[model samples]
Target: MSKIKVGVIGCGSIAKHRHLPEYANNNNVEIIAVCDIVKERVSEIAKEYQAIAYTDYEELLANPEVDAVSVCTPNYLHAPISIAALQAGKHVLCEKPMATSIKDAEQMIEAAKESNKKLMIAHNQRFVPSHQKARQLIEKGEVGKIYSFRTAFGHGGPEGWSADGVNSWFFKKEQAYIGALGDLGVHKTDLLRFILGEEFTDVGAFVETSSKENADVDDTAVCVLKTESGIIGTLAASWSYVSKEDNSTIIYGENAILRLEDDPVNSLVVQYKNGEVVKYELGGIQTNDAGGQTNTQVIDQFVSALIENTEPVVNGEEGYKSLKVVLAALQSSETRQITSL
Candidate 1:
């Protein structure tokens, strides 16, 4: 196919603000359809993009013209929609946290393998320049051996991003499955995994609905992780930060200490044990909260992977692995003990 015909399933804030716009920007993609349970939302996005609209995702998947799909639905629906899309012979780019449970994520992976279709999860932080640079440094042995690290992602709350404001699906435990951990924590979990290139072996955490008045989900969460390579660290995620702090990993290695943060300019600060401290400031790659240019970069990579017949940078398996860390952390929080991954 000269241009990949794509369908977007889910017309929520993520679809409208991130996925659709990024897909629209890619010249090699032709958005053929949009689907959402809410007819008005689907119609609005469809009209905006000049594409057909459907209330049911299955109908959209059945369209012969659609070669790929962006599964922008809620946490619970991710697995079923992605699996069905792959079964319908369409490549899938599902949103992060893969699914609410490991079983569902495995099913999605199995569907992709069975259909021989690509299944990529949208872990956009992996595409950020600063994060990429950090990975490069680690791979090149510039930091020697990673010992421990800290990462975090925080914001005002879901009310600002959700279409329903205070009554959003993010607050509904049944819909979101978990609270701050799934929404913001997963990103850090994925990022730590990506940067460290190591799997977490155990996790201990504390989670609570500390600030949100009536929300059933957690507003704040903190976790400690032990990697298979003997590295240990902490990850913090919150939807209650009055002033957002998108700070992240401070990797201490034998040779250097690397500090990464997303404020005053995205940057990676490295302090060598030899007394050399270098700070590389990356002008924000994309819009901050929306993950701006990184979203487009990730989508471009996914499409390129399809055309090249190669594996995606953040495939279903990788998404599942990252999600396992979050799941272990949640289990740790609930049990007040270290949970094995």
Candidate 2:
């Protein structure tokens, strides 16, 4: 196929700022269709992209012209919509969190396997240039063995990005499942796993809905995590930062300390124990919340995976592993104890 025909479900902030724009920018992708429950949203996107608009994703999935789909729906609809798209013989590029439940995640994976289609999760944090560079340095033993770390993502909340603003599905417990933990925490969990090259083994957390008086879901959370290799750290995700966004990670190692997305000018910085400091002015993480539409290296990679007949960077299994950490944190919060993954 000269170009992969694509359909995007859910005309939310992610779809508008990430998936649709990136796919449109990619030379190997063609926007075949778009779907969303909101007719105006879908129609506007369809007109902008010159694609068919559908009120139901199933109709778009049924179109044989669609070679793949980007599932950008709410957390609860992610699994079902993605499964339907995959079963319809179209590859799936699902948004983060994979699913709200393990059972649903497993089902989506099984469906993808059964259909022999690519299933990639849109975990863009791993695709950041600083993150990639940090991983490389760690692999080359530039940081020595990692000791502990603190990673966090915070912002004013989804009200700035969600299509419905303050009344979006993001604030609904039934649709979002978990709030900040699912929205932002999952990215940190996945990022730690990618850079550290390990799986989380246990988690203890305090997930709460302390912000947004009207929301039933968690607006803030702090998690203490332990990796399989005995590495321990804390992960914080909150929607109460009231000011600028904070998407930073600091990893302490035996030789040096690696900081990512933490500086005003540098993207990655290393401070050695021997009084040497290194700073890399690579670039900033894609701040979709700030109205940037730069390619996230997520959409094009999914397209490349389809064209090359290869697995995506963050596949179903990888997504599930990351998601399990968040799930465990929720359980830990409720039980007031550490929960093993």
Candidate 3:
């Protein structure tokens, strides 16, 4: 195949803002079709990209022209749509949180294995330049003996990002399953694991819906996590920050502290115990702003993995593990006790 013919399932905000534009920029990809339950959304996106439109995703998967698919649907539809696409002999690039539950995530992974097709999770934070650099630094032991950290991802809410605005499925429990925790928390879970090179073994959480009227899902979550290596940290996800998004991490170690995405000018900063301070001017994290150059290398990475027949950095199993941490947090909150992963 000279170029990968791609079908995008769900022409929602993510497709319109991230996946579609990135695929268009990749010369190795040719978008063959678009599917969405919303006819207007699918039609407009398909016309703009010169691809076939379908309201049903199964119809799009049945198109033999499509060699791969980007599943940008709601959390509830992720596993089923991805499994069907894989079964239809197409590679899948699924959005984060993998599925609403581990059972569904495992099922999707099993389907991918049965089909012998690539299955990558779109954990875009893992593709961020600063995050990549941070991982490199941590692996090199720049901060000796990691002790604790605090990471958070917060914004006004999904209303600003969802195509449906206030009425987006993000606030509905049936479609979203969980709110800020699933939407933003899982990203942090994946990122912290990537950065620290550790797996969380236990979690204690306080999840609540402090804001967003009529939202049945949690709008805020604060979790205390312990890693396998005994490192402790706090993970917070919130939709209450109305003014600006806070996507920052502070890693405290025996030697120094590393700050990530905390400053506007410098994406990374390190403070040594010897009183030496270093700042790195990496790029800014991508936001809802439309005109800036996108930093999410997810599309490019997914295409490369497909072409090279290699595993993506954030594959199905990786997504499943990160989601386990998020789910553990929810369980801990409900039971009022620490949950073991």
* 276: Cα error in model 1, Å: 1.9
Report how far off residue 195 is in candidate 2 (Å). Answer: 0.4
Name the candidate, 1 or 2, with the larger TM-score value.
Answer: 2
Candidate 1: 10-residue stretch with minimal lDDT: 285-294
Give the alpha carbon lDDT tens digit for every residue of 33-108 in model 3: 9999898878899899999999988888889989999999989999999999999999999998789999999999
How high is the CA lDDT of each candidate model? 0.87, 0.93, 0.92
RMSD of 3: 1.0
**TM-scores, each model vs. reference:** 0.96, 0.99, 0.98
lDDT of 1 at 329: 84
| Candidate 3 vs. true structure, TM-score | 0.98
lDDT of 3: 0.92
Candidate 3: the clashing residue pairs are none
Stretches off by above 4 angstroms in model 3 are: 290-293
| Candidate number achieving the greatest lDDT relative to the actual structure | 2
At residue 162, give the lDDT of candidate 3: 88
lDDT of model 1, residue 33? 95
lDDT of 2: 0.93
Q: Across residues 236-281, which tens digit of lDDT does each residue of candidate 2 receive?
A: 9999889889999999999999999999899999999999999999
Off by over 4 Å in 2: none
Query: What's the C-alpha lDDT at position 177 in model 1?
Result: 88
